[model samples]
Target: MARNKNRTEVKNYKKKKLTVSTSEESPAKKKKMSPKDPEDPDDALSKVESPEMKDLEDLTPEEQRKRERKLKKERKKEEKRLKRESAIDDDDEEEKPSKPSVCELSLQYLKSWSEKRKDWKFQKTRQIWLLQNMYDQEKISDDYFPILLEYLEGLKGSARDTTVKQAEDLMKEYDKSEAKAEADVQKMSRIREVLQLLS
Candidate 1:
């Protein structure tokens, strides 16, 4: 009887531990990883490894071609799913999306303009600018504007006017040891060099 009681106590203890640990996981995570279907090695391997890759493999060859054709349509949806998941993970810290002031938005839009890069040209820049203006006129709130600004700060512009403006801005604030001064000047010159290639 004592041995049986001890065995029962150990079993209960193990169950308690498992429950405690599992409680931290999500319901989606609770779903068992489905075994790789042997008939589809790619699918099986992907499932055991990367679900994203597996999902891609699950499609028939013909369906895959169709899938590629519609990638543009699906890109936004995939991005939204990732964004939602990221937002969920960031629940510990509440994030407040800041609307860019008109001046800030204009500055950002101008900064994104490229005049001569292989992929980015004046035409595309103008299109984006027009789109931005239309969005503003339509009173469409851009929650991603600030995020866009972060990327814009890193993009290389391809126009002389924009390059010169960027350099002048750098020259103006070159002296004040605010933050990342040397890096700022270097980045500005790099942008200028890229723009110079257009000429």
Candidate 2:
């Protein structure tokens, strides 16, 4: 059997493996080393300030520290103001919804109908909304109350009955309270005015 020369491993007697010991430092290694003082006043690294505060370098050390502190406080205050403004904007967006309420839609429809009654078709939902919200001054303003009452002239079925029922009830309340309090007298008279107009 022939021995393959490629399979045989050759060891060089001249070559040697080098191992570094932790105790020795290599001459090839060069590094800058310095001692850190915890209380050194002239320490550049310890006295480093923000880029914006670099302009204050010409001031006295005490003045520089004070200016830096003042600048930091002003920066934080401005940030807080911006945050508050953004929060208020978000709140406003949340409070004021994009879509109008049923009352608004009802009022819009009523106004359109009032302007062009022949062109504008009647909507049951708007009629019902007007009937429901007519009593509340907050929901239906005094300016539009008369118009809503006029619109109610064409109301029929249970809706018309309900309005009469509510109007009679309001009248009773008004007459009873007339001697005691005259606060809602104007409110009751609004319904009465409509009844008079209808009659």
Candidate 3:
């Protein structure tokens, strides 16, 4: 009877050990099976309280000034970064060929003449001279040329005759250049045909 009771007690003790071991192992296994928490710095920062925050509401004047200076420095850095980015954007825009506004075109034309004639007395004459140069160089697009010409023609003064004469002279020169280009093209075609015949 003593031997049988001892056997029974040993079996109960084994069962209890198994149950305790399983309970501990099960929690560990569950921990391994569960998904890991995300590693976001912002989340961690949000959860953590800064030491400065506790004293923020009751800051001494010196501490307050230091904090203000730090904030101002960060703001200035941000502003500088933004300014640099904006300047880069502006440079990109400048690289793209944008059509000149009428005012800009007119100013460019006037500037061209002003550079040539320092003592150019009359503003009206200067404008007319600029128009003549613009037409000659083909700086203004063909579509906008007539519009500019009309604007110049509407201006009444002693410079009107000089301006009209200059326009006529430029047109004649333009026609001659066009004729010369056509002749060159014809000559090239003739040479190409002769070469083809030889081949």
Candidate 4:
């Protein structure tokens, strides 16, 4: 391990003896931390060998049982903390109000025209939606159907006539079907209502 090759010549000479005073402890012995020294938690741990730090095989049966109980308690405490966190998250989600989409907002806006007619201005897209879905029982709820009828009082010439013609044709087509479904019967009733309103 010597860095210089020529340094091997000194190996033949006898090694110098190191003298130790009888008052001092042996160099190989471990030193105890003094009370006056700066306190270090790890230094304290190093001085005192803890029984809990020993291997499982070195532990007594009672000590092993105590350790097992401590581990079980820690696991149960962690599970309880996780359960509390998830419960808080679920409560937060329940408290939050869901925002309505653009389509639903538009429909609600049109419905509000009954109360605020001064706010009513012609929207071609909304008029088109009324013409397309006015007669469908599924698309138009019964509560909103009459409201939409009042709204259509504003519709002039062709759109009004088209709505009437469409209702008549759908009603005739539905009447011809011998084995009508419950949903079709519902639609036929709504078409009759539409024809009565617009015709």
Q: Highest TM-score: which candidate? A: 4
Candidate 3 per-residue C-alpha lDDT over 2-108 given as tens digits, one digit per residue, 9 for 90 to 100:
99976775565455435434233433332332224548654445323433333333455665465446545645665698899999999987877779765565655
Over 4 Å off in model 3, which ranges? Answer: 1-61, 86-90, 93-131, 134-157, 160-199
Report the lDDT tens digits of candidate 1 across residue range 92-157: 488678797665554444445432245443445543453333213133224433333343445455
- Which stretches of candidate 1 lie above 4 Å from their native place? 1-122, 126-159, 181-185, 191-199
Off by over 4 Å in 4: 1-103
What is candidate 2's lDDT per residue for 1-199, written digit by digit as tens?
A: 2355322311111111012121142222101011236466544443453222243454557655655565456456656988999999999878665798888899899899789888898788888788776767778888898788778777778877777877777778777763643436556667686566444
Rank ordering of all candidates by lDDT, starting from the highest: 4, 2, 3, 1
The alpha-carbon lDDT assigned to residue 61 of candidate 2 equals 71
TM-score of 3: 0.28
- What CA RMSD would you report for each candidate? 22.5, 19.3, 23.3, 17.2
Candidate 1 backbone overlaps, count:
0
lDDT of 4 by residue, 76-187 (tens): 6656988999999999878667697544654775776777778866677777876787666666677887788777767788888888788888888887889888888888
Ranked by TM-score, the better of candidates 1 and 4 is 4
TM-score: the better of candidates 2 and 3: 2
lDDT of 2 at 190: 72
Better of 1 and 3 by TM-score: 3
